[model samples]
Target: MSYIKAGTDVNGNDVKLHYIDQGQGSPIVLIHGWPATYEMWEYQLAELPKHGHRVIAYTRRGFGNSSKTWEGNDYDTLADDLNAVLETLDLQDVTLVGFSMGGGEVARYMSRYNGARVSKVAFVSAVTPFLLKTDDNPDGADKSVFDDMVDGIRKDRFDFLQSFGKKFFGVGVISHPVSQATLDWMQSICQLASPRATEQCVYAFAATDFRQDLATLKVPTLVIHGSSDDTVPAKVSGERMTQYVSHAQFVEYSGAPHGLFVTEKERLNRDILAFAAGGTVEGTADRY
Candidate 1:
């Protein structure tokens, strides 16, 4: 891994983004979910490269070692920050992967920058299309959920994460319970983020609509979600998002929780590798 650093312009206002570059060949950029730093994708960072793909995973603006400012935590700026990293590195034929909140960055990237120089896109248990329920979006998540999230954090961040972390991995799910170690590690990462970023992003992810972006994405896409995902249920997010994509391959892990990356790491990695390699899947987009 190269030395960790942030990019800055003439004014030094700070385009603070930190990422790890590894391996050789086609690039795969992994954007982490909410309340998680680059460390969350440790498995992908370590395993994907062994298959000969250059992997890049980064902490979003306020997570990990990146600068944490009071404002500009919105999705548009987040997407711009991601694009800056890609453009600075002059990456091409890249496979952009977004998980959970990070998925917003992917959608915004394609919508805002027209996915400049991107090859493929993927979402893992992401929040997209539209998360918060509204007049037209009847199946969406409730605004109260997001409000409660901000409430929880403002009330007591560390305690809130301890419980939020449990819901994230579906601790009591009988089929596949996430290990306690993973849950604790997840909380650690979540707590590492700027509390302000964590609080503000709740409003961003819940309110932002990506239906337009998803419809216009002119790249092969992968939509992976867990059937039992409690946070961003597949029915509202991944399942519904397929309708917007022109050419998409949807994979729903049966009874899998939202954090399938940890619960079902190996299978998820293979699916991602296959998607990046242009491998075929039996099911079609319309099937979802």
Candidate 2:
């Protein structure tokens, strides 16, 4: 793992993103979500290379050990940072995978960067299409919901994260398949993120609309969500995402929670490998 200067953001703040590249063959750049770093994809990092696929995971600005810039927590800059990573490496025919807030980065990358050098995209327990409720977005969440989240995070980031982590993994909210140690592990990683960045990102992912970005995605796409997701519910996110992307395959992990990547590692890994190999994906997936 190395930290490379990814160039300054729009605000002229110099930012260095931490990233690691491994294995050979086509590249797969995995983007993580709010309050998380590239390390969030540790499982993929360890396994994908063994299967003949290069795995590249990077920490976004303000997350993990990356430079914590005060400005630019929205999707536009986040997406730009991701594009910069792939461009720096001159990687092509790449499969971009984004989880949670990273899903917004994937959409923005396609629309903002024109999907240059990108062949495929994937969303795992993502937040996409439109998350906030407005006059036009009737199915989205209430304004107060997001407002309260930002308030709570600003008030006490650590405490708020402690509560958010439960819903994130669906511990008591649903039947989560992880031990307390696993939950603690996730929290430790989250604690590494800058509190301000974490707070601002709640607004970025919750309020930003990616409907147009979804339309811009022309390549093959994969959507995976836990049926019992509580953080970003399947009902609001992946379920509707299947309708947005042009050529997309959807996977639902029954009884799995928001952190299905941990709760259902074996199954999730199999699906990821199959998709990366360009194998025929079932048009639709029944619950796991």
Whole-model lDDT, model 1: 0.85
User: lDDT tens digits, residues 1-288, model 1?
Assistant: 332334553456665677788899899999999889888888888899999799998888877777776677889888888887788788999999999998989999999998888999998999988898999899987888889889989999999999888878887655438777888888887887898999999999999999988887989898899998998899999988778885777888888888888888988888888889998643334444
| Candidate 1: residue 7 lDDT (0-100) | 53
Instruction: Residues 1-288, candidate 2: write the lDDT tens digits.
Output: 587677886688779999999999999988987887787787878888888888899999988899888887888988888888988889999989898899999999999999999998999999998899999888899989989998988898788878887888777744556678877788889999998798889899999999999988888888998888888888998988867775677888887788777777777777888888888554356232
Query: How does each model score on TM-score?
Result: 0.94, 0.94
TM-score of 2: 0.94
- Residue 93 in model 1: lDDT: 94
List per-prediction Cα lDDT, in the order shown: 0.85, 0.85
Listing every candidate in turn, what is its Cα RMSD in Å to the true structure after a full C-alpha superposition? 2.2, 2.3
Q: For model 2, what is the error of residue 212's alpha carbon versus the real structure, in angstroms, after optimal superposition?
A: 0.4
Q: After superposition, how far is residue 190 of candidate 1 from its true place, in Å?
A: 1.0
